[model samples]
Target: MRLLPWTGAGGKPCYLSTDDPHSPLSRLADDIEALHLADAAGVLEGARAVLDDPGAGEHAVRFALARAVESLGDTLRVAVSRGECA
Candidate 1:
């Protein structure tokens, strides 16, 4: 059983049962995880630049914060999917 990155309609965790790591579902999950990680890296770079700039506006800060939260969630989901949680 492998946990999925996204939740169900009712906020329940989604799982896939597959012994083959190269299954279609597994590949899909890998692709999503890669995308999330890439997004997180970009967001972190942008956030750092925004924070370093004294003239940064409230809107830019808020956007960076929101993106950070999303990235965190995505990272956590990937961890859960890999059974990293105890």
Candidate 2:
């Protein structure tokens, strides 16, 4: 999965690309809301772990991707909570 975030320095919040962004969770945003939430959570958790742990052993590039994914999830949650997911 490839995630691009808007926040903090540079154009990305966290930098990591996934081999697959079409997970069941991502499908929620398109075909199912519930699945989207679950997938989004997965992305966020991955990002949060990297953010909280600098030496998490994740390569710099991968770490950045995780951060970006986390930020993207946060953005999505905000939008959903605001009833903008219609």
Candidate 3:
């Protein structure tokens, strides 16, 4: 079973039960994971800065938070997928 990079509509973890690691979905997940990791540092810093500022606008905070949550979900999916292989 492989964990997909996106959650279901009900906020549940979605898993792909398959033996092929080279499937299209798996490759897409890998790409998404790579992109997230590459931008992690910048996103973390931006979010931290926005959160630390007392006068930051709600829009800025919300955007940062949304990105953080999405990135976390993607990272978790990748980890779960790798663990299944292990």
| Strongest candidate by TM-score | 1
Candidate 1: stretches off by over 4 Å:
none
Candidate 2 deviates by what RMSD? 11.7
Candidate that beats the other on lDDT, 1 or 2, i.e. the better one: 1
Q: Residue 35 CA error for candidate 3 (Å)?
A: 2.4
- What shift in Å separates residue 81 of candidate 3 from its native position after superposition? 2.7
Model 3 clash count equals 0
Q: What are the runs in model 3 whose C-alpha is more than 4 Å off? A: 51-66, 84-86
**Candidate 3 residues 3-71, lDDT tens each?**
777778898877878778798987887787787676676788899999999999989999999988877
Writing each residue's lDDT as its tens digit, candidate 2 over 1-86 gives 22332234664443234455586544433344355556677766767777788676658548668656665666675454436653
Sort by TM-score, best first: what order?
1, 3, 2
Tens digits of lDDT, candidate 1, 1-86: 88887789899888889898899888988898899889889989999998998999999999989989889889888877778864
Q: Quote the positional error of residue 25 for candidate 2 in Å.
A: 17
The TM-score values for the models, in the order shown, are 0.91, 0.35, 0.60
